[model samples]
Target: MQDIAREAGVSSKTVSRVSNGSDSVRPATRDMVLAVMDRLGYRPNFAARALKRGRFKAIGVAMFDIVATGNLLTLEGITKAASDLDYAVTITMMGKGQQRSLAAVVERMKNLPVDGVIVILEQMLPDVGTFVPPAGMEVLLVTSAQSTTMSTIDEDQYGCSTMVTNYFLDRGHRTVHFVSGPEESLDSHFREQGWIDALARRGVVAPPVIRGDWSADSGFNAGLELAHVKDCTAIYAANDNEAYGVMQGLAAAGKRVPDDVSVIGVDDVLRNLIPRLTLTSVKMNFGAVGRRAFRMVARAIEDPQRSRPTRELIPGVLVERSSVRDLTR
Candidate 1:
């Protein structure tokens, strides 16, 4: 700090203000200090400074699987939010490829020097009881299951499936077939229940739900089977990837989309991957969920006594495209 201040012909306090991003400093002085900093290759030692201030000014993020699109998008939101808030983020992949006990996560994070943690659960929490973070550690969870101790954020998954199913029913389809994601995923289960409940409301019995592991291959198999379901006219896939596979399988089986079997999916991400397929789908605001989670955790950090909202749900919107057939007309 002193070296940079001397080099830039400014006081140590001015350097401190510039480093901390305080708006009190004049723009010219801030620029001069930053230029000097660049010339000297001096970087802010956030961790060291955090230790001195009694607050890390940093948050840890734990993702079960960072490879998942939803998790990655949420992380993007979190990093952007943290940057804007002048905080740092450290991530730990708790469950990389297999299931891990909550106790293990607690143990791993016990000594980590962060004020709080944002956990993104890629799979359902193990049958283990409550997940209690280490003492003095605040946790904000992004997951599908309920938690009493940890704050959680989720998309309105139930509402998402219900809306899509109702769309089909409102279009004069007697029932909508379902292609579900992994059985262990609470997200898939919630969506599947939503579809079932919606169909039940109209006194329409839900046919068997085809199972997919969120893989295009699984969706392809589901498509092949549904191709032979004589009266199955509408399908609600667990996600856009599955829908894409279903479409490919249907095409290979001489079945035409919308004309033969109207299909829809969730997550609305396939359009980027397959530009030619005009698939109707639901849009999940994954980044919003991430930003909200950061805010929730940050609140717990800044004001330890403040009571935070236990749960928040970001809603999904239906993105209309060319895949579904509207028979109501």
Candidate 2:
């Protein structure tokens, strides 16, 4: 500290102000202090600074994995937004049991200087009332899950599902079958609701939904079952992977897609690479979900007292592909 002060031709107190990012320091003085610190290899100790501010300049993000395509895209948005704001991000991976896994991470963060936390809901099954957030820190829950109080940013799962269902019904199909994600999943549940809503609006009876764990194999199994049914003309799987399975199952049964049955998926995953397999699906802007989550976090961090708890919904666009035929005509 003394060396930097002497090199910058300023007192130690003046050097301290620049190091702490105080706006009161004169521009020339701040520049001189920064230069001296850089030349002297002086690094500000964030831990020490955190103790003074009672908050870390970094935000903690909790998610299951960093590798999933959707998760990775969302992460990119979060990192980009945080970088633009000059904030650091700390990512914690929660595996297996939710109660134990996430609670441990939260405890660890409590020991550090994190200013806020953004909990990504993928693979997160937190126990009821498990999150006891830190007293002076802000918390944001970024998820597709529904709750009245939690701040969330996600797609309109219900609306998009209804759109797909209506697509089939309008085409003169009497019933639409749904290949849903795990029953415990709220995303899957909301999508199912959307399908039912569409059926009700059209005055058609909604058929029973088949279950999948968001896996290709599960979709394949559900497809095999549906293939045997006489009136199963269209299927809306929870995601693209499952839709691929549906295609395989239909092919094995000697049924051609859009001819025997049309398959629609939620995600347009890598659709351009496979020219022959035209998967008509919904294209969700997951990156926008991530961006919105960070924006909410930033707002909460900037003015914790005035920020209101709010939920933001990002809509999805349906991409028409060969997988689904316009049966309305």
Candidate 3:
């Protein structure tokens, strides 16, 4: 520190302030000190800093799958927010099926050297009672279920699902059919419930849900079946990939979108590639969920006793496009 200060012709205090990112230092002096440090290849000792601050300056994120579009986007948001807050994120992916349990994952994360932890719920856990966090460990959840023990952040899946379905029903469609995600997914659960609730409110019975594995291929198969159902005029898919596959299947079956049938989906993905398709979708603010989760975890870490369990719901908006036909028009 003193060497850099001497070389930059500044006091040691000025160099220290610059290195610590303090705004008290003059801009020119801070620039000069940074240049000197860069030229000298000076690196701050993270271990020493952590010891002094009593924090690892890092957070751990545990998830079952990272390849899913929604999970990937949420992770991106987490990474961005953590970087902005000067915290590092360590990601751990738990394998699918019986390879791991929620209790096991929570225990493993407790052993890690992170100041806090965020759990991304990709599937329904067997028992929520067994997934308790250790004392003093800050924890957050991103799931559809309302949590009473930890801070939870999620997109309002039920409301968005109902909104899209109601949009179709109001357009003179007798009823809205659904393409659902995996049976074990909480998102699929809430979205399907929302669809059913919307129909029930209108005194109409909902059609049997067509199940998909969150893949375009599964949606294609479901679409093939719906194509044959002459009364299936409106379809609401759980996500955008499924909607794309449904569109392809409809085209192959000699059905025209918004003419013979209208299609709507959640997750406005791949909009640039298929602009002509103009698929209407429910757009989720996944970035907001991630940022809020991080903030909650940070608060817990700062004062665990004062931080109470809170639920944050990020709402999705309906993006209008050419996919759905307005029969009233």
Candidate 4:
């Protein structure tokens, strides 16, 4: 630090600030200090720093799968947020056998060099019990896993589904059919509950749900079946992949979108595809969920004794496009 400070002609405090990623130093000063450090091959010893501060300045992210688009976006948000705070991130995937218990699964992350952990639920069993992290370890849950007693930061699955259903109903569609994610998924559970609740609010009977595995193929299969239902004029799929598949199936069955039937879905992640169809979908902010989850976990790390919120729901919005028809007009 002294050598770099002298080389950069800045006080040791200025060098320290730049090295610690503090923004208080001017850009020019920070740059000069960084250049000096690079020339001197001076890399801060993270191990020593962690020992001195009693914190790793790193976080662990545990997930079932990151291949899914929403999960992938959430991870990106978390990593970016961690970077901004000058913290490092370590990631691990939960094993299927570990699904027996949330705490057991989380215990796997204890060996990781992170100050805290963020468990991202994907296929968390509905019956999985409460998660109690190892003593002195802070943890947060992200996404849908209603079974756990752990604090969670979830995307508004119920609200998104309810909003989409109500949009169809308000547009004069008497009732709406739903294509739901797999039953084991908490996201699917909340979304299905919302769809039914929304219909009941309007005194309309909620139709039987068509279950899908969060895949376009399952959605395509559901679409084929829905084609024959006489009153199934509006459909809300659980996700964009399934929604796109549903549209294709509807097309195959000679059911023109927004004409013979209209369809809307969640996770506008794929709204760009099927350019002609242009799905009117709800936009899920998984990235925001990730950012917020990271921030929440960081706070826990900062003050382990502070109170933590039980849950936080990040709401999404509707992006109207061509797929849904305004029947009232």
Candidate 5:
């Protein structure tokens, strides 16, 4: 303290005031003290700084992987938001084939000096409830991983499912079969429920539901099963990948799209835009999901005391294409 005071030609109190951004320091005196501290490479300890100001100025992000398009967009959204707010971000990438356990990641963050964490949703990974967050630390769940106290943000999966299913139903289809994702996934269940609800609304008994693991292969298998059902005139797939597989299966079985059977899926992937044979689907602004989650986490970090944990939903829009027969015509 005395050394810095001597170097800056100022008193110890002036150095303290300048370092803490207190109002008492004169402009010239503050500059002199800052210059001396810089020359001496005197960095403030973050822990001590946090104690003085009640903020760590850092946030943690835990994602399943960066390769997935949705996760990548989420990462970008988080980074952009953090940069705009002048906050430092530390991102931890989970494993490739085997998911990195949330327990281990949360433990690591607990020991670090970061203020909060934002976890990207991964259905293959186990529930996040196993990992206990640090006392007073904010944790935001960006996906459907369950947490008793964490703030959560997700797309309106059920709503999307209902919109597409109703569209098919309104077209005068006798029954619409569903190709769903894994049973364990929250989105999958919500979507399936929506399909069931839509059928119930029309006083029609819901048809048997085929489960997929959110992959093209599963959709293909489910499609083959649907082809044999003579009454199956319409199909609703979980995602675009599954929809593509369903198309292949229908073609191999000598059935034409919209002519023989109509189809609808969710997630408007880039490849779905190809004009040759456009697959009608429900479009989701995944980037918005990421941005909303990031903002929620940021807000939670800033107002840890006054903010209450909340769950936010992003809506989806149905994109009409040639995949459906337009039975009304």
Candidate 6:
């Protein structure tokens, strides 16, 4: 510190402020100190800092799977939020069951230098009761499931599902068929329940749901089955990938979208990749959920006394496109 301070023509205190990213230091002085440090190959001792302050200025994020689109987007949001708050993030991917247990993962995160941890819930973490955090470890769960023990931030899956189902119903479709995601997913369950509730409200008998693995291939397979059902006019896919597959299957079966089988999906991801399809989907702000989850973790870390377990739900909006056809018109 003294060498860098002398080299930059600044006091040791000024060097300390610059190293800590204090805004009180003038921009030019900060830059000069940074340049001197770079020239000297100086790196801040995070371990010592953590030991002194009882914080690492870092957070750990654990996910059961990283391949899902929703998880990917949520992670993006988390990193952005963490960066904005000047905190570092360490990510850990837990492999499939028995391969890596939640207990083991939590232990690993506890060993990390992070002050708080955020766990992105998946099939593995279905029962929060089974998992417990280390002492004084602040934890947040990003999931649709309700949890009384941990803070949670999730997208309004049920409400969005109802909106899409009602969207098809209002278009004069007798009933909307559903292509659900994997059975184990809480998100899929919520969406499926919403579809059922929507149908029940209109006194319409809900059709059998076609199950998918949250994949375009699964959707295509479900779509092929729907093609065989003559009365299948409107379809609500759990996600965009499934909807895309359904479109393919319908096309292969000589079914025209909107004109023959109207389709809607959740998670507006398909529009960005398949612009020509013009898919009408429920737009979920997974990014916002991620950001909020990070903020909650930060609060828990910074002010543990005031931080309480809270559940926050992010709403979804229906993005209209050319996929649904109005029969009443």
Clashes of each: 0, 3, 0, 0, 0, 0
lDDT (10s digit) by residue, model 2, range 74-190 = 888888888888788988777665444445666766665567777777644555245545556677776666555456777788888988998888887888999998886667888
Screening candidate 2 with a backbone cut-off below 3 angstroms (N, C-alpha, C), the clashing residue pairs are 56-113, 171-327, 171-328
TM values, all candidates: 0.90, 0.87, 0.89, 0.87, 0.78, 0.92
RMSD of each: 2.3, 2.8, 2.6, 3.2, 4.5, 2.0
State model 1's lDDT. 0.86
* lDDT of each candidate versus the true structure: 0.86, 0.80, 0.85, 0.84, 0.78, 0.87
Model 5 lDDT tens row, 9-61: 88888877776667788888888888899999887676887888887777888
CA error at residue 131 for candidate 5, angstroms: 8.3
- Tell me the lDDT of model 5 at 236: 95
Candidate 4's displacement at residue 187, Å, is 1.0
Candidate 5 positional error at 273, Å: 6.7
For candidate 4, give the lDDT of residue 239: 89
Candidate 3, residue 76: the lDDT equals 89
Q: Which candidate achieves the best lDDT against the true structure?
A: 6
Worst 10 residues of 2 by lDDT: 123-132
* Clash list (residue pairs), candidate 1: none
lDDT of 2 at 64: 72
Off by over 4 Å in 6: 10-13, 23-28, 97-102, 124-127, 130-132
Q: Which stretches of candidate 4 lie over 4 Å from their true place?
A: 1-36, 97-100, 125-129, 144-149
| Global fold similarity of model 1 (TM-score) | 0.90
Tell me how far the alpha carbon of residue 195 in candidate 4 is from the true structure, in angstroms, after superposition.
0.8
Candidate 4 residue-wise lDDT, 106-135, digit = tens: 566666678888878766644346445666
